[model samples]
Target chain A: MKCARCLEDTAAKVADAPDGSGAWEIYLCSRCNYSWRTTEEEEVINPEKRDPYFTLDGVDMDDLMVLVPVPPLKK
Target chain B: MGCMPACKFKPLNNKRKNQGVNNLYRDLREFLAKLEEEGQLVRYTDEILPEPDVRHICRASGDMPNGPAVLMNNIKGYKGKRLVVNVHGSWANHALSFGMDKDTSPKEQFHELCNRWDNYPGEVKFVDNAPCQEVVIKDDINLFDLLPLYRINPYDGGYYFGKGNVISQDPDEPDNLDKENVGIYRMQVQGKDIIGMQALAFHDISIQLAKVEAENKPLPVAIALGVDPVLSFIASTPIYYDQSEYKFAAALNGIPQELTKAVTSNINVPAGAEFVLEGEIIPRQRFPEGPFGEFPGSYSGIRKQVRIKVKAITHRKDPIFENLYIGRPWTEADFLLGLNTCVPLYRQLKETMPEVEAVNALYQHGLTAIIATGNRFGGYAKSVAMRVASTPHGISYCKNIILVDDDVDPFDLMQVMWALSTRVRADKDVIVIPHTPGMPLDPASEPPGMGNKLIIDATSPAPPDSVMREVRMVDRMPQALEVEKIIAELQKSAGK
Candidate 1:
């Protein structure tokens, strides 16, 4: 990773830490000792690889035609 | 309105000897005191009994913020021995510790973390050796001889190494030594001679570690028992793959992180570390471990995991063992993994799904994560949801992904659930996808190493879906200024 400061090539890695009781992962580089998370190699998946037909609610994708805003309660 | 100064870094030199090293806190009292002074920590000096520490604290403390990082230095049983427990186990403390804004939403915090990553410059101030080297157990060491490693929650198979940074430098990537190849993975203790490495293959660190194994070389490893709050934070988050974790920490600390090389391995460690254990990962080492409390809120019994051979144990002269609990609700499980990794990760995902509004990692500890976004018609939420679940980090453990409207706070389980209840028809809005890489710690692992994941499209559907005409009402928390007025009046009346 290029050092954000000197732009010199350096060894770095993120440190494991707790951001309170919430969740967080810290990034750190060993060479220049810099820390931060970058969007460079991040992968975000809605459903993991080899997803099945049903979701957490047991709903299928092909046949479902759901409504938006969801009608309010009858009561 | 904006983030603090961006993270910065500087090059290290072998020319410097005995320069400045972080003041390593060997004593539990000193560690707490330092944290308090820096405002990165608080202490409860409250007296609490042992037998029920896990049940009493983790069960009741899940939702409270600003909880003293929890150091029960004085315990009734197990001969006192000064057991250091409860450090960084609250949501507010998480923010305060990192100098983040408490008023900022979790989703916003995640965004700032991502922004911080963009300008972060990893830094390391090298010193010959510091406190972690103050007391070294080079030859052979007994596990039980040191601090009390608690069996948190009843079903725990045994006392685990719940506290410690299991670090490994990529042996195959000597050329990639710009701090980009270092990794601090968490390992669970299985025996005096074994600990579990629950790394998923998708983790770049794990993938690199595998490369070392394939090359048949012992993977050099070190575990720092205690470190300054920010340094510890660096090890846990998914900031950047090529960037150094410590530099990210420096960015957070707004200062250079001091480092000293490990006596055994070539890996550099935080100089302020209370204790550092140096070792190596042997290839194909198997052990029967677990039955420990997982984030799923269950005792996942005996699973196959890698067994680590204890090498040398090194620490300050009188090191106090830090015991962090797991299982049930509000444990460090969510603190370090769920809450911490989620924020920065939410930002990284936005790089792909730019319109995504916010994200939250549920209490299920990586197994369940939620994301909220503004719908742009034509499967926008679904596509973004897919990317979120597919993120290298998310693929490993996140299942049960929920996408909600921007009006909903992904971090707020209530709002997410509300979207699921009102906008979702169970059979319609809910979109299911499965069979992805999962947490090795997850009990649902299929035979021959296979697992499944599902995403529930809980977002409000595209416009003109016939349901857009539906009316909905949502409640908001009281404003901060109003609450402040009441508190100020109460304080003044009491004073007068």
Candidate 2:
């Protein structure tokens, strides 16, 4: 696997996906210590356990804040 | 059990067949043998210094899934003096060391432990002879030359006798074994027959010493090293002041604890211990000790601590020196101290709020706690947080208390963090106490032993606002076992 930031062949392990699936994996470039995640979808995402990020809306400040790095604008 | 029963608890999974009864480890050697049999012990033949090198390996090795316990056979300077580190390193190994079923869930283990704090006086058998007293050296005592004492951190003051239990009886009740207190305190080797022991002011030993010093008398003590592995856990735990650890240990193992009277003092030492240092803490003798790395993951500055004049040294033939690294996370201290704090706190919290699902003392550091409860009333989490922070056993050294909803698993750091990030608000959810009792070693605290405490109410909102969460669940929530199975299958296929 190639790291997105370093563009070098890297080692990787399956990481918890944003949607909680085994499909996604995180790769790390050993030389530069850069990492990125990729997904290999094998099954449909269950609505009850779908990607929390997918359901996020600007008005849903709490969930949106959780998915993003920064807090949402005041209501 | 003198204390009121907090909650009705029965051991979980009783319907599951009981594994055949196995003998509990009698001493350090037997515990090592058990670990070896289970393929959980690794020995290093290469000579390593008793200082940073051994601790470094222990710190690194503890991160493995079921990390093997380390036994260093050769020391850099000391000859024929073997050193054992990290017998309590791994979670699996730690559970096994205490004769607990490793397959059971952490919640089940907590339930099983809830009733262990009762005041039942179990058998403490005293034999006429003991292995610890096989070779008694009353004169010409040189601690450095005889034992391979460890200097764990680079900035430590001097060589320390780590992982030893100091046994002392209340001076006022000289003849009563029930009033005896055994605690794990670090001893810095000062000279041929003297060592500085750090028994902090909060400890029961300090209280007993204060009373003795007021009476103008020295407190008799026997420091036992390399004892039965279970006793180490018992000593590290916060058994009430009135309860003796010997009895608690005896009750926990369903076996009698064997003790031997020290030659130089009336105090009793574990009969199966590898070594015993008989000594007395003089009425007013004080010496500078520490600036050493403590369990809080920081250095505690130098302070005046009581010094012990070693009157006699007793040990078995070929004694193994057991040690532990105090600083940083993911060490044995985390597991021991975490359970010690969590079990009692869970019981006490349950007495008030039975909805408390679980509690976790994050590291051996014991500064932070993660609690899971079902309470959803407005300001309920605040009350839960306050109760946990003020409980005598819980608040002693802890600074951060996080309360999560019942759906969150407190033991899993990821789940707890997820709750904190998704459910909590800095303005509304965070409650801060301006000043409270704090651990002396925490560098952030302004004064040595006093600081602020933070309560993070990470629980999901109650009533009308609770529905806003969208009843979310991670798809991978139930895939833990599947993930483990797949990983094992892949490793087997890859011939790893």
Which 10 residues in a row give candidate 2 chain B its minimum summed lDDT? B1-10
lDDT of 2 at B160: 76
lDDT of 1 by residue, B1-496 (tens): 1221211111112332112123333233454775576554544345444435534654545445545555455443334445555566665555544555333345444555554555467466776757778887866464543544444654344456665776666665643545444344445554444456555455555655566656555667777776766666667766556777767667656567777878876777777777777777666544434445766555653444454667877777656666566676667656766555666656666676656666677445556777777777846787777787677667666766778877676766786777888777666666656566666556676542356766677777776453556666656655875898899989988956
Model 2: lDDT equals: 0.69
Give the Cα error of residue B150 in candidate 1, in Å. 2.6
lDDT per residue for candidate 2 within B75-159, as digits (tens), equals 5555466888778877767767766665555555555555444524678999987999889999988775677665576545556
Residue A38, candidate 2: how far off, in angstroms? 54
lDDT of each: 0.56, 0.69
| Displacement of the residue B165 alpha carbon in candidate 2, Å | 0.3
- Per model, the share of native interface contacts recovered reads 0.00, 0.00
TM-score of chain B of each: 0.79, 0.88
